[model samples]
Target: MTTPSGDPTDHEHWRRPADLEPGQPAPRPAAPAAPETPGYQGPPPTTPATTGWRPPTVVNPMAPRQLPSQDQDSIDADERGARTLTYGIAMVGGAVLVIVICLLCSRVLF
Candidate 1:
């Protein structure tokens, strides 16, 4: 682990078995030169009309804006009768607590 001229088996700092020979590849660097005003050419003739977020030519009041058909069937029949009266009062309070725990275990074993 020492090779700044201090030899630890330095082939210029190691990894030498004659420099690889089973696949090939190692050479890629050349892609940077595209700046001639590459986009947006729609509105800037001294900014006179629509600038600063112009997405509403007619209707875009922060769009998700859609509820105008009879108040969506009266709020979908009031959220489907409030989820069917909360699952019919939790199945009639689980069948009246299983018939009051089977009449309190048949009067505590008669």
Candidate 2:
């Protein structure tokens, strides 16, 4: 690469070793000047507020209850009667199924 001629007038053409020619005087390096201090004094201002969108709030209406309160004795008797009827129906059905299975098994074996 070619060295720069270091001419003040030919500033545009200068590239580098950045070194001066042998007989030329070395130029003193200039101290960099500081940037000017900013004059901003306060916090930045905010934009005006505006309401955009809102969802509606709602309550569910309750259904009317029409059941009447009854005596404790009557309620207990009703529950017992229901359970007894269920057990009786289950026993009768199971007995009929067992009898039918036994009859089928005997006929097949014979």
Candidate 3:
């Protein structure tokens, strides 16, 4: 893709192949060849101890993310407001439905 001014750029056009139909699945990728282990080739060891076992240490990929206090406050406020609005709508709808039913009953009884 290039800018409207017709300048040449690095981007290449990506689209469906001309030969393939729209609904057909894309061609499957060739499966990767299995890796070979060298030197010690015997029946695989049954247990970790057989292969000189060592306890593995866990490492976190990334530190825990925390929003700033202001952001957290804003998010909390938004959540509260949404909950309040939902509850208010439900209450009003229920009240209106009950009033309509009561009025109908009064007209029928009188």
lDDT of 2 by residue, 52-77 (tens): 75566597678988898779999899
Candidate with top TM-score is 2
Model 1: worst 10 consecutive residues (lDDT sum): 13-22
Q: What are the per-residue Cα lDDT tens digits for candidate 3 across 1-53?
A: 54545445733345677788999998988999989868777898685455666
lDDT tens string, model 1, 1-110?
Answer: 54486655756643434555656554466888877885877875684665676654885477576876678788999999999999999999999999999999999999
Residue 107 lDDT, candidate 2, scale 0-100: 100
lDDT order, best first, reads 2, 3, 1
> Looking at model 3, which ten-residue stretch has the lowest summed lDDT?
4-13
TM-score of model 3 (CA atoms): 0.35
Candidate 2 residue runs with Cα over 4 Å from true position:
1-67
Off by over 4 Å in 3: 1-70
Candidate closer to the true structure by TM-score (higher is better), 2 or 3: 2
